[model samples]
Target: MASHLDLEEQEQLEQVKAFWKRWGNLITWVLTAALAAYAGWQGWNWYQRDQAAKAGAMYDEFQRAATAQDADKAAAAAGDLKARYPGTGYAAQAGLEVARLQLDKGKADEARQSLAWVAEQGSEPAYRDLARLRLAGLQLDAKAYDDAAKTLDAVKSPEFAGLVADRRGDALLLQGKHDAAKAEYQKALAAIDKTQDYRRIVEAKLATLGVPTVVEAAPNAGAVQ
Candidate 1:
């Protein structure tokens, strides 16, 4: 009986060895690949966290410089953040600050460049829209008529519809298209909340074009509550 049991155990062990021989390399390779992928995923997470932390600190510095009205310092810090962390949201925000400061400093061309980059390449859609709006306004002021219209045309926010129309009206007025301007002004009025006090400004714009006020001083026309 002992010899028989020994023979059975030997056979089982040989069978196990044969299975390993057939599948060992494949199993080992699969395990290696899985472990490597997990390590890579963990490394990627750590890298992103580190980048965000650094970018956030730099952005705080940029904000402080902006608050102090140190335009040059703000621009320089923001530029550094943007160059080093262009993939971060903070970088896009810094671009906005730098653009505004440049504009305030009468650096129109530089402002346009910064604003255009933010508008076209910002990481967030909302920030991109805001940049486009501001850029459109600047271009309008510079009489870059076609460019302003094109930028404004790209804005698709429902909330910005009224403002865009109002700006378009301004652009048209500058181009001596009073009739078209009036139409756009009317659209702006229609887009705005009738109860918003700002609607009065739109009304005034329409009045300037000799269009009969459709929403005079109705108490409800400018009340929110």
Candidate 2:
């Protein structure tokens, strides 16, 4: 009986060895690939953390320069951020901040360059959209009506849709397209939230174009609580 049991165990051991001989390479390869992938993912997580830390430091430096009203230092810091961290959100923010500073100091062309960088290179859609909006405003101020209209056309963020339409209307109006401007203003009025003060601006724009807007009345505060 012991001899028979030993024979059965030997046969099972042979079966397992045969199975390993057939599939060992495949199993080994699969495990190797999975381990490599996990390592790569971990490496990527570390790289991203390092990048964010460095970018945050640069952004803080830019903010400090800006706060001290040091235009040259702020511009330098912004340039460095743009050059080194264009892939990071801090670059877009620094671009916008420096652009604002430049504008306040009457450096319209420099501000335009900064805003254009944010509009074209920002990783975030919202940042690009905001940059485009401000850039279009600068174009409008310069009386580049066609350019302003074209710039506004590039703003596709849903949150800024109404504002874009309003700007488009202003551009068209400046270009003497009164009917088209009025239509754009109407779209702005339709899309803007009633509670927002910006909606009132759009309403006024529509009113100027002879389009009457029916204002929504405020609910009675004491009706229910």
Candidate 3:
């Protein structure tokens, strides 16, 4: 009986060995891949955090230079941020700041260059929309009505719908398309929220264009509480 048990144990050991021989390499590779992927994910997260920290520091430098009214230093810091962290929000904000400083210095062409970059390549859609809006405004000021209309047409954010309409109205007004401008101002007024004071400004614009104002009714006072 002891000999028989030894023979059964040896058979079981051999069966185990056969299974390992069939699948050992595949199992080892699977585990190695999983470990490598986990390490890569960790390394990527660490790299992103480090990049963000560096970008934040550079943005602070930009803000300090802008506050001090040093356009050259601000532009340098902004350029550094854009070069090192173009995927970051800091880069987009830096572009806006640098463009503003350029505008303050009466460098309209330089401002347009910076704004065009943000409009085309910003990492965030909201920032891109803002860049387009500001770019349209600059084009309007430059009497590039066709370009301003095209830029305003590119704004896709619903939040800016009213503002886009208003700017489009301005472009049309400047092009001597009074009827089209009035229609756009009407659209702007319709899109704007009643709570926003900007609605009143739009209404005033419409009035200036000889569009009769329709008084909005006051809200009910909640049935005497």
Candidate 4:
């Protein structure tokens, strides 16, 4: 009976060895892949956090220079931020600030370069729209009517539709396209928010073109929270 029991134990050990031989390599590979993926995920999180922290520090330096009204310092800091951390929101904001400073210092060409960069490369649509609007305004002031029109045409955000139409009207008016300008102003009036003070400015613009002003209706009480 003991010998029979020993033979059965030996048979069970052999079965276990056979199962390991068939499946052990696949199990090891699966566990290795899972561990590598986990490590990669952790590394990605660490990298993002490090980038944000560095960008934040750079932004602080830019803000200090801007507040001091030091155009050269601000421009340098902004250039650094944009170069090192173009993906960060701070970089786009820095570009806007740098452009404003350059403009204030009568560096029109430099200002245009900064604004063009933001318009072309800003991560946020809103920032790009703002840059385009400002850039078009500069072009208009310089009497580059065709360029201003082209810049305004590039603005595609619905939120900026009214402003773009208004700007387009201004460009057309400068080019002596009175009828087209009037039509654009009408479109601007239709699209502008009724509550904005700027809407009244659009109304005044229409009046200058001999178009009757449309009064905005007051909001219904039921529509108020």
Candidate 5:
């Protein structure tokens, strides 16, 4: 019996060795690739954290300059942060802050330049949209009516659609296109929430133009809210 068991165990060991001989190199390569991938992921995570830390320090400098009401310093710091870390959200925020500071100092041209840069260079859509809106406002004030219209047209957020349309109406009104202005204003009114105070201003604009109110009734024709 011992001799028979020893022979069976030897045969099983030989089969295991044959299997390893066939697949050992393939399994070893697969495990090596997996380990390399995990190491690469850890390295990438470390790099991102380091980048964000550096960007944050630069952004803090920009914020401090802005808070001190030093427009030149704020602008300089913001520009540096933006140039060095344009991929950071903080950089875009700093741009907006700098633009606001420039505007408050009555530096329209400088503010417009700042806003234009933010509009063009911001990594985040929200900051870009805000910059575009302010830039359009500045253009409108400068009597660049068509340019303002074009800029506002690029703002894609539905939440800002009404305000953009309203600004377009103002531009059209300035250009003596009364009918077009009325249509744009109507679109603004339609886009705005009825309960919003701003809707009253739209209503008043439409009223002044003698355009008939076309408020569509809610779908629940007979039910009370």
Candidate 6:
């Protein structure tokens, strides 16, 4: 019985050896690939953390220069953020700050350029939308009515929908299209939340355009109370 059991064990060992011989290379390759991928994923996470830290430091430098009103220093830091961390929110925010500084210095064209960069290449949707809105405002002030319209057309976020319509109304009014402007302002008024103060501004605009804003009636107290 011991000899029979030994023979069975030998046969089982031979079968395992044959199976390994057929599949060992593939298994080794798969494990090597998996380990390499895991290592790469870990390295990528480390690289992103390092990049964010560096970008945040540079953004701090920009804030300091901006607070000091040192235009040149602020511009330098903003440019650096743009060049090295274009994928970061810091770059877009720095660009916005630079645009504000430029506008404050009466450099309208320079401000437009900075805002255009942010509008086109910002890393966040809200930043891009804000840049576009500001750029459109600048364009409107410059009497580039058509350009302002074109810029407003690019604003797609629902959060900015009312503001975009309002700006479009301003552009139309500037072009002497009173009826079109009134329609746009009406749309703005409807899109804006009633509880917010901005709707008052829109309502005032509609009033100027000969559209009487309907005062909302009070909600019935029994309903949903």
Q: Indicate the TM-score of model 2.
A: 0.89
- Judged by whole-model lDDT over C-alpha atoms, candidate 4 comes out at 0.93
TM-score of each: 0.77, 0.89, 0.87, 0.82, 0.78, 0.89
Better of 1 and 5 by lDDT: 1
Q: How big is the RMSD of model 1?
A: 4.7
lDDT of 5 by residue, 1-225 (tens): 999999999999999999999999999999999999999999989988887899899888988888999999999998888888888788888888898899998888998888888888888788888888889999999999878878897888778888888888888888888899999999999899888889878878778888877668789988977
Pitting candidate 2 against candidate 3, the one with the higher TM-score is 2
Tens-digit lDDT track of model 6 for 1-225: 999999999999999999999999999999999999999999999998999999999999999999998877888899999999998999999999999998998889989999999999999989999999999999999999888888888888998999999999999899999999998898888888888899989988888777789766687945775
Give the Cα lDDT of each candidate.
0.89, 0.91, 0.92, 0.93, 0.88, 0.93
Residue 199's lDDT within candidate 5 is: 82
Local accuracy of candidate 2 as per-residue lDDT tens digits, 1-225: 999999999999999999999999999999999999999999999998998899999999999999998878999999998898888999999999999999998999999999999999997999999999999999999998878878888998899988898899888888889999999998887788888888888877778888888755688846776
- Return the clash pairs for model 1, or none: none
Writing each residue's lDDT as its tens digit, candidate 4 over 1-225 gives 999999999999999999989998999999999999999999999998999899999999999999999999999999999899998789999999999999999999889989998999897999999999999999998999989888988898999999999999999899899999999999998999988899998889889999989756777845856
- Name the lDDT value of residue 186 in candidate 5: 92
What candidate 2 gets wrong by more than 4 Å, as runs, is 214-225
The ten-residue window of minimal lDDT in model 4 covers: 215-224
lDDT tens digits by residue: candidate 3, 73-93: 988888888888999999999
lDDT for 47 (candidate 3)? 97
Model 5 pairs in collision: none
C-alpha displacement of 6 in model 4, angstroms?
Answer: 9.5
**lDDT head-to-head 3 vs 4, winner:** 4
Misplaced by over 4 Å in model 5 are 1-26, 211-225
Write down the worst ten-residue block by lDDT for model 2.
215-224
